[model samples]
Target: MEHEESNRSEFLVFPLSQVRKEGYKVTRKAPPSATDWSRRATRTQRGILDGSLGHYKGKAVPKGGCSAFAAQTLMKGTKPHRIRIEGMSITHDASATPDGIIDTVLSVMRYSTAVKSDSDERVKGVKGKWSSCMRKAGFQYASPQAAANDSRWSKGNVPTRLETSVAVADMQCKKKVRYLDTLVDVQSEYERNAIAEQSATLASLQSDAKVWLSNAKDEVNKQPATKRD
Candidate 1:
């Protein structure tokens, strides 16, 4: 009995005779190894590599991603370098140092100061014009709210208003204090002159008094000669 040939038949498969033939060789790429993955990561961190990449915090997948695909999907929604300060938009780059962050904050502060200066100048001009107009009309310009709350505007209640005024007064006081500090640098010169002038005047008066007392003593010693006779 002839056994039926196995369902699988061996065909006469031959390698292409010429190495230069397009189908002569079929090469399969190997899956990335651990070293390959590490090199890829280094390149990415250095911003040399293109396309999406994964980042992990620890042993498990990161909160955002498990692979390049997941990481790319998450980062697509991310906004980079958006910052704000005191209701104003500020531009900043990603920072790796605390000092860089501080610089960004200072930049925002400088911008705010510039804006405040411009506003104050405009307000000053407007207030000056309003004051002049009110003066010419012989009418005082006062806040109706202040008039309604007499206690809030009264001189007798000044101490109670300290809390409200302290902020502005404190700023003025700080400027004065700085001016005083500058004056203190020259204080020694003034003090030296004062001490020298005072001491010289006092010494001259003492010398004159001593001379007068000596003359008086001599006169007293010579007196009463006629009286003795």
Candidate 2:
């Protein structure tokens, strides 16, 4: 599952703004107004996969050979809605091995441990400014994350009057404090330093990834395309 960008002010504003305009009521089952493509796609894929299973369809799933292949290939027919956000793009390939992607992600995450967001003194300072800004705007949240995670909003089906208000103030405060810009700068600096420190390891990982992708594509090309293709 993709992690919600609760700490970032940019991602939450649009959805919360909609809540403000529409007076959307909060419900236990309601998801956040904003969702990223990865999470959206994952949810779509999971739902479709569940339905595609034979047991779920009140029949034994087709057994053996091409039947199994077709079962696994059910998601190839799904088209998910796309959303554009700053510095983001959506990309997917059914032919790609999940293992290859998982391994590459794990390799990158291993080095990422060197730069924890909360441990950065710069982030802490900007958060302080953001807290003060929110206070001036009539909210008492410690940070954007704190405001987003406030438990009161989740306790009832009715929309809290302050949910939209707090979200608006959160976005405004982030702008006033240049929170995203400063946070990005500090994050980029730490990442660059980490890259410099792990240049050889990262390079090897990238090289391996390229080879894996090339092989995956070749394998896909070897398969016969269906009539739907």
- Name the best candidate (by TM-score): 2
lDDT of each residue in 1-229, candidate 1, tens digit only: 1112211111111122211121111111144574655555664443322223344333333333333333233223223354455576544322212234345555555455444533454434433444344344443433212222334333442234332332223222223333222223333344444445446433443454455456556656776766563
Best by lDDT: 2
Residue lDDT tens for model 2, 76-162: 333322222122322224433335444544445434633465568888998899999988887898776678678866666656667
Candidate 2 runs further than 4 Å off? 1-16, 22-115, 156-158, 221-229
Candidate 2 yields a Cα-based lDDT of 0.55
Error of 2 at 195 (Å): 2.4
Cα-based lDDT at residue 105, candidate 1:
52
Task: List TM-scores for all candidates, in order.
Answer: 0.18, 0.54
The lDDT per prediction is 0.35, 0.55
